[model samples]
Target: MKTFRLMSQIHLWLGAAFGVQVMLWLISGLAMVLIPIESIRGEHLRSDEPTPAIDWADRALPLAEIIDGQSLTVLSARTGMLADTPVWRLETPAGPVMVDAIAGQSLTPVSEALATQIALSRQIGLGEIVSVTSLDSPPREAGLSVPAWRIEFAAGETTPPTTFYINSRTGELRAVRTAAWRIYDIFWGIHIMDWSSRENFNSWWIKVTSIIAILFGLTGVYLTVHRLWMMARRRKAERLGGGGS
Candidate 1:
C-alpha cells in the first residue's frame, strides 16, 4: 500500500508538471495535420489573355527607367511575339510588371494588385487568417504569346507559401498556391515556429519547456508500471490464504 501510494503521487506530479506542454504539442500537431499551410496563406489566382499588339522591337524609350518608381528590383527583357519586339519584365513591390518595348506602353497593372495581395498574405500569417482564397477554382482564359517568364517572391520558410507568376506579354499576375516549391514554405514555417509560433520558437524558453515535458512523460510511465506491479503483488498475497474466505 505504501509503495503504491508513493508511485501514484509521483505520477500525479509528473502529469501536473508536464500537462501544459503535452497539451500544446497535441494541439499544434493536430492543427498541422488537419490544416494545409497553403490554405492558411491564401488561394491561387490565375488568368490568361492575349495582350494588345505592338510593332516588333520599335518603341525606343528606356523601359527600365519608366518602372523605376514602382519599387522595381530585378529587371530583364525578352523578344515579344513579333520579330524585334522587346518585352520588358520587372520585379516590383506589388509583383511583376510587363511593358511593351515597341509601343512604349505598360501592358497590365498586375504589379500593384499582386504586391498588395502578397503583403496581405504575409500579415495574415501573423494569425490574422481570413478565408479569402476559398473560391472553388481560379478562372482560366486563353494564353497570350507576348513573352512569358515566372517570378518567385521569397516565402519565408513554409510549404505552399504565396508566389506570383508574371506574363511578360500581358503583365498578368497569377498567385501560385500549390507546387513543389511550396512544400519548402510549410517545413520552414514549422521549423521557425517550432510548433508554437505565438511564443516565438527562437526563444530559449521553448527549448527548456520541451525538454522538461519529455522528462515528465518518461517519469510518469515508469511510476505507472511500478504501481501496477505493487497492486498485483498485494492482490496475490491476499488471495493466497492471507485473506481467503
Candidate 2:
C-alpha cells in the first residue's frame, strides 16, 4: 500500500511536470513521419534535368591561367556546373567565385538573370516562377552561409510554393525549402529541445526530459503490477475465508 501510494504520487507529479515535453516528442515524431522525406526534400518535384558534365580538362585553360592576378588567395579550384553551363568553381579568401573554364575569365557572383536560369535549369518540375531574390550575403534562414539566389515558385492549388536557394558563385543548389520541410524543421527543433539552433539534438533539455520520461514509465509499470498483486491477494483471502466458514 505504501509503495502504491508512493508510485501514484511520483507518476502524478511526473506527468504534471513533464507532460508538455512528452506531448512535444509525440507530436514532433508524428509530424516527421507523416510527411514523406522525398517530398519534404523537394525531390519528388524535380525533373531529371541533365546538367552539363565537366569536359574541360584538356581543352580548357590551365589552373594558373584561371587564377592569374586575382587579389585574394585562391584556396581551391575545381571544374563544375553553373546551371547547364560548365565552369570552374574557385574558393578564395573572400568567398566562392566561378571562372569560365575555356575562357579563364572570372564569372561569378552571377547576375539575377543567370540565377533565374540556374533555378529553371535545376528544378524544371516545380511550379511557375513567381519571384527572384538575391543577397550579397546569404540570408539567416538559409542553413548555408554562401551568398545565394532565392527563387520562389507560385503556390499550387493544393500545396504551398517551394523555394530553392542557388549559390550565386558556383550556381550550386544549396537548399530546397518546401512547406512540408519548413514545418518538419520546426518540429525537429522542438523535438530536440533546441529552440535556437534547431540542429542540436544533444541539448541538456532533452537529456533531462528523457530521464524524466524513463522514470515516469517505470513508475507506471510498478503501479500496474502492484494493482494486480493486490487484487490477487484479495481473491486468495476470500477463497480461504469461504473454505474455513
Candidate 3:
C-alpha cells in the first residue's frame, strides 16, 4: 500500500512537471507527420526552367584563356548558364568564379537585376518582387550557405510569401523558403526545445523533460499494477473469511 501510494505521488508530480512538454511533443509530432515534407518546403511553388543546350560550335573561349590573368587556384570547373548566358563556373581556393564561355570574361559578383530575374524565372505563381538583399551569413533556414542573394516575393492570399536564396558567384539556386516553412520551423523549435537555433535536439532541457516524462509513465504503470494486486488480495481475503465463518 505504501509503495503504491509513493508511486502514485511520483506519477502525479512528474506529470504535473512535464505534462505541457509531453503534450507539445505529441502535438508537434502529429503536425509534422500529417504535413508532407515537400509541402512544407514549398516545392510545388517553384517552376524549374529547363537547361538550355550549350552550342559547342560557336567559337567559345578556352578555359585557360578565361583564367589566364586571374591568380586563382582552380579546384573544379563546369559549364552552366548564368541567367540566359552560358558560362564556365569555376570553384577556386578563394571562392566561386563564373567566366563567359564566349567572351572569356569573368562574371563574378552577380548583379541585383540578374538575381531578381533568376528568382522570378524559378517561381510559378503570381508574385511580385518584394525586396532583394545580399547576405554574407546563413539565414534561419538550414541548407543556405553564405554569400547569397535573398529575393523576396509577395504572393497571393492562397500562396505564402516566398524567399529565394541564390548563390552570388555561381548563380545557383541554393534554397527556397516560404511562410509554411516558417510555421513548421516554429513548431519544430518548440518540439526540440531549441528555441534559438531550432536545430539542437540534444539540449539539457529536452533531456530533463524526457527523463521526467519517462518516470511519469513508469510510475503510472506501477501504480496501476499495484492497485489491481491489492484489489485481488482484498477479494481473496473476503472469500476466505466467508468460507471460515
Best candidate (score: lDDT): 3
Evaluation by TM-score, superior candidate among 1 and 3 = 3
lDDT by residue (97-197, candidate 2, tens digit) is 88878777677877888888877877745678999988768764566676788889887665568898877776677778886887888888988899888
How far is 45's C-alpha from truth in model 1 (Å)?
A: 6.0
For candidate 3, write residues 63-181 as lDDT tens digits.
77776756788888888877677888888888889887887777778878888877777787847888999888857683666578988889856787888888887777878888778
lDDT of 1 at 3: 62
Better of 1 and 3 by lDDT: 3
| Candidate 2 or 1, higher TM-score | 2
Q: Supply every candidate's count of residue pairs whose N, Cα or C atoms clash at under 3 angstroms.
A: 14, 0, 0
Model 1 agreement with the true structure over 1-245: per-residue lDDT tens digits: 67656666766776776676566556656656565654543443222333435553345556556555344565554433211235565555555565655565565543444433433433322322223321122322112233333333444434333444434334344345444434444444444444333325666656766676676666677777876887998889888967666
TM-score for every candidate vs. truth? 0.39, 0.79, 0.87
lDDT of 2: 0.79
Q: What are the clashing pairs of model 2?
A: none
lDDT of each: 0.48, 0.79, 0.81
What RMSD value applies to candidate 2? 3.3
